[model samples]
Target chain A: MARVQANGVDHHVQVLPAKGAPLGTAVFVHGAFIDSLASFYFTLGPQFAEAGIDAVLYDLRGHGRSERPPTGYTLQDFTADLDALLDALRIEEPVHLVGNSFGGTIALDYAVHHPERAATVTVVESGPATQDWAHTMAGALDQATEQLPPEEALDWFVAEYGAIASTRQGDGRHDAHIRRLGRNAGKFIATTTIARDIPDGRVLSDGEVRQIRCPVLLINGSEGLVAEQTAWLAELLPGTQVRVVAGQKHSVLVEAAEEVGALALDFVITEADKAAALEASLDAALEGGRTR
Target chain B: MKAVKATQTPPIPDEAQVLAEISEMIMSVLGDYAPPEGDAAITLDSRFGDDLEMESIDLVTLSGRLAEWYGPEVNFAEYLASLELDEIIELTVGRLVSYVARSLRTAATAAAER
Candidate 1:
């Protein structure tokens, strides 16, 4: 419910503080296009809070309640937004970065650039921002930009998945939400440089990818778009754990929230505990040195 | 600036008042997508998903508005966390009104006791 100006844009943010003694903070970065902070708000935000981990959720620029300028939608812009948001919040401690889809790409890039600020990185159904990723994203965004402008395109979604879409989140089928999503998508694509900037943005090289030293967890659905990247990602990052949810797809974050929430909760708690133990030992060492 | 008053208990809104206030909040959140039936379409049994066609995100916006109007005493996020996901998806306007009314009354009572 708060609007904080970060990176010179008003970003809508919601923070769910830990229920008891705070273990750590986990900032959730949601997917682009039809997605917003509400994706995590209703699913993982509360779960994280109840688990003694502060959850930070925010709408990406040009996506939700946040102000949307006509341009500046590059990968680096998103990475800078995350950095400025942390500074605005005055959170100095390293945080566990959890991201979904395109959001995961941004999180991975941020971790690479600022390894000291990120304790652990969890990517759900996403891979690092490589040249291949940019090309695929360009194709998808091009298709959306072309198809979503027509009113008939919205009708097609309503006719196809309208019935079951009501019960599901982010299904892009509910009549009002679908229509609104289509309108918003059309406006965003037509007005902004996202479709161009994202694909043309900075991509990590193999050497840069290998530099991430913190623990990384890659969660993907068996049939998801990026499931194959798990093996290569494991090889690239040494401290990596992989979990492929059976009989799921790209929308696993919403489709299998219960399992994902549990997995994420366990990972954050374990990582937070390890971080606390390490900090305590370091403090003890310093105290011992001073006394001697 | 207005002169500050000592701590005092605010009046607890009745069910109808709460309903009216929440209905206004919903309309404001929905904006152009609001139903043609207008405020009358929002009733006790009107489902947020099926009737209003509200995504879960609308609730987040509504919760923000509620906090603005009622202050921190009416904690919408905590109240929502108490429910199962299905219950939230099937949430109704009346259920929210009841929660807000109850919370206001509880806050008023606590303030009076102090």
Candidate 2:
């Protein structure tokens, strides 16, 4: 794993270099629980870099190879980690943020909090971090916990989600998700701290969405788990537009990696920031004579 | 500042030699857990993940060794910074060897001109 120390913690980051002339940076954020950066790393992150854009995918705190300190699972903390990640990497310019599930919540929140730093926001089956979402997640956690204790739950996860992850990787490979989750199976399943700290619903208000200055691309299935919330979000942001991927629900990210990768590629190439990144990369490539 | 350039072709390690070195580097990086090496067919189209599934940390380590061997004229990190993720996945050892050859030639020519 390509590890980067951001916000004073180790984030397992997959840094794909650009293929052609550099265009812009596309940062991928993963959803919470059971999901990690590996989703984008193997699927779409490489596509962006191949298009001459820098691509970054990192395992959220407590998720993958990062140091899980037993705390700091809130949106504010997540957003702060994002901020410090860019800072540590010296990414001074604005970037395109692509988020999946809970990761989208942080992306939307970060966009609202730091409008100038975000060029565009693309969300895949995610809605704003709202009270409804918090309640839903909390309830879901409770429901699952009624069946928790880790051992049986993990067995279930392995049998169920593990199968899905295996299919995604194709072939009979059972590692990626299993490997990452296996590393944290005990801690993730046994603890409710993260679920407990998932800030009460409505993390971002309607007015806050209106404050967003960047373009937004919201991809969801017709009946995405967050279907109800997307409507509220669309009504609030002027630049927000929804694109529904056929036959995909909340698990759209995995089920439709190819389609999503194409959509993301088109979004980045069409964005105005492409020119700036291109010029900068050209300069870097032209500048020579640095001693080895 | 006045820049000095290169024009002559810079000496690069032979392709077979470089490939052998890279193969060894990969073996050490993957340790005992690495899968079977894709021989003969492992040409210019092979990649790190699809053709070779080493741990991510090993890839990072391999990248550093590449920089050391190729020097600054041919930086994999710099080259990758411009590549799309698909290209990274489709990256073959032969392709990298070709890139080093081309980049070295370009740098040599540039230095001589300067």
Candidate 3:
């Protein structure tokens, strides 16, 4: 575990490199209400290494081992943290940006704004940023905070979405998380600033979609709400691929680790191959044109 | 909301044929959620949730798929809001048939006038 001070917080990150061949680096930004490398990254990070891919798993601001400041949990903060991590680690090459849930949205926004910094972007169980869905989910979190007592609410949250949460056991910390969520609803509310900022972001124009020269991949749960959206994105984005793991829900990274990791590896390798071919073709064309 | 054509030279198929086409279309788009016994008798009144166990996510996906089939020209959100499962299932299929039928009628009328 590596700790770096990013955005006034000591964010915890774990870097795993392949045994012999380091293909390219992957920096994973985690989802909401969860933290640390212990979650999905722990299970799937090695899979990346096994496939000769380097992995960087980190806790987002205000979650896990990162500094829990009183406020400033906007998506931009997370983006800056990612940028800082890359610079600090001396990752000169474009790294594959991988994210889950809200992290996935943040990754997408980052890639859109900074296409040059990203090799390719992969989002697991996420959709284009939408205010209504964010509001609805935030509202759900708030209601769960208010209606159910801390202990009871925590239990319900764990029982229903335990597999999704980063915590291994349903215990005191989980209850503490529930209470913190209840208390921090105000600060947490501002986290949706990205959603508001990108109201028209969902329906990307053909030109805008085409501008994403990097390959994109969206993974979804077979039974999750975002499956259709995932399929739509795969079709919409240029050089994008969509895959669904059977019997998986929104937490593809957590629930279906092997399958998700395999798919990610395949996409990265495939994108690399295509990029190489395109470069070769361009070089040949330029040479032919120059000779003529 | 265009008026249904009243021509007889190229006779319009009855409601049964329209319903069959609707079922086939729905099945193609909504493979799993589509009820096995879907037919024209599956009225606009038929509830996807109650009758077909179609969840909200399924409905949203179905709406998106329906939009793709009909073309980006269709007012999908308005149509989705106005129609229920039965109504939508019928209207979507009905709309396709109506559009084709209307175009043929208009062309025939133009030829006769000429």
Best by TM-score: 1
Worst 10 residues of 2 chain A by lDDT: A165-174
Could you give candidate 3's per-residue lDDT for residues B20-53 as a string of tens digits?
A: 5444544554566465663534543444434444
Give the alpha carbon lDDT tens digit for every residue of A1-292 in model 3.
Answer: 4688766778767676665778788888777663344444435566666677788877776665566665555656667778887878788888888888877877876776678889988888886554555566656665555566755665566555645433333454444433444334334333534223223234334455556767788888776657656755667674678888887766557546667878988998777667768889999999999999
Per-residue accuracy of model 2 over A2-48 as CA lDDT, tens digit each: 57887777887767777877778888999887677766765667678
Q: Candidates 2 and 3: which is better by DockQ?
A: 2
- Report lDDT (Cα) of residue A280, candidate 3: 95
Question: Please, what is the whole-model Cα lDDT of each candidate in the order they appear?
Answer: 0.81, 0.71, 0.60
Give interface RMSD, every candidate, in order: 3.1, 6.7, 18.3
How do the candidates rank by lDDT, highest first?
1, 2, 3
Better-scoring candidate (TM-score), 1 or 3: 1
Q: Rank the candidates by DockQ, best first.
A: 1, 2, 3
Q: C-alpha displacement of A56 in model 3, angstroms?
A: 1.3
**Model 2 chain B: worst 10 consecutive residues (lDDT sum):** B1-10
Please give the range of 10 consecutive residues that has the lowest summed lDDT in model 3 chain A: A194-203
